[model samples]
Target: MVKVQQSKFVASAKKLTQCPPEDIAEIAFLGRSNVGKSTFINLLSNHFKLAKSSSTPGKTQLINFFESIWIFKEEQYKMRFVDLPGFGYAKVAKTLKEEWKKDLWEFLNCRSTIKLFIHLVDSRHTQLEIDLQVSQMLEKLCRGDQSVLKIYTKCDKLNSNQRALLSKQGLLLSTNQNLIKSQHGGVETIRLEILKKVFGYEG
Candidate 1:
């Protein structure tokens, strides 16, 4: 099984200008606060504390990076997981919120090393405006050069049948319906296909 050989905190970015310069290929995880972005990163990397997770919304106030070195077939390659701060918290000041948006936009638009953007969404709530905005931002950034994958988080909360149904319905309603249909079926199936198409692997 693929495993994260090393995962350590790299840096934090309150402003995109403050982000570190790196040439490594990067994949980012973004979602509204309390949507499980941190948990998802931890689960994928097989490191519980790799990304700080919390039930409290808006816990992450800055961009957190985890330097992940994956080991497979006795070869090693470095990967970066960017945990972007969750937006849409009602208690945040308007000025701070705007700064956060600007920071996110700069990182997504200016970071040349970013190879993939993983848009995470809560499986139970499919119609969040903030999530849609994030998706659109990634789409624009892709500019036909790269790709973005939408991941419906918290799938373990659903039974197999419920998961399948949700995936089917999500595919049917998405703009990329054909792409979803070409997969085994539904959102989870489509998610796997998207990952392969975008990142050149199922991971």
Candidate 2:
């Protein structure tokens, strides 16, 4: 069975300067507030509190980090998860919101350890303008080594035809359901894809 052998909060930072200087592989989780990013991370790690979830959106202002080790059969891999602050709809003062965006942009474009960007979008609201902006920003800022994965959250709410359409669109979609049988084990599939990106496909 695939399991999170070790998962712990590492640190929280407001900017790249304040972040840990480790050069290890990192996966960045970013999305609009209330998009289930924290819950998705929890499901992936099998540690519910590894990333904090808030009833009110935009509660996570700082960039939170988590170090985790995963064991699947005989293979083990270590990596960091960077939970970026939610943007766009945050109910912050306009002045402070600008500053937050500045810090977030700097972190996203300058963080060298980030091997992949997991951009979570709510499946029900797939046409949101904010998500498109974030997707554009990721594509524009991504380097040769970094790739972006857009996983749609709450996919179990979608019907089979909608899910099939999303699949046909060539988008990497996933659900936050903890069940291994849900949506063909979507969460586990995402975990394995993340592991492959971090450690290569040798295992």
Best by TM-score: 2
- Clashing pairs in model 2, backbone N/Cα/C closer than 3 A: none
Model 1 lDDT at residue 13: 81
- CA lDDT scores, all candidates in order: 0.68, 0.80
Model 1 local distance difference test score: 0.68
lDDT score for residue 122 of model 2: 84
Once model 1 is optimally superposed onto the true structure by TM-score, how far is the C-alpha of residue 83 displaced, in angstroms? 0.5
Which regions of candidate 1 fall more than 4 Å away from where they truly are?
54-56, 168-203
Model 2 CA deviation exceeding 4 Å by range = 170-185
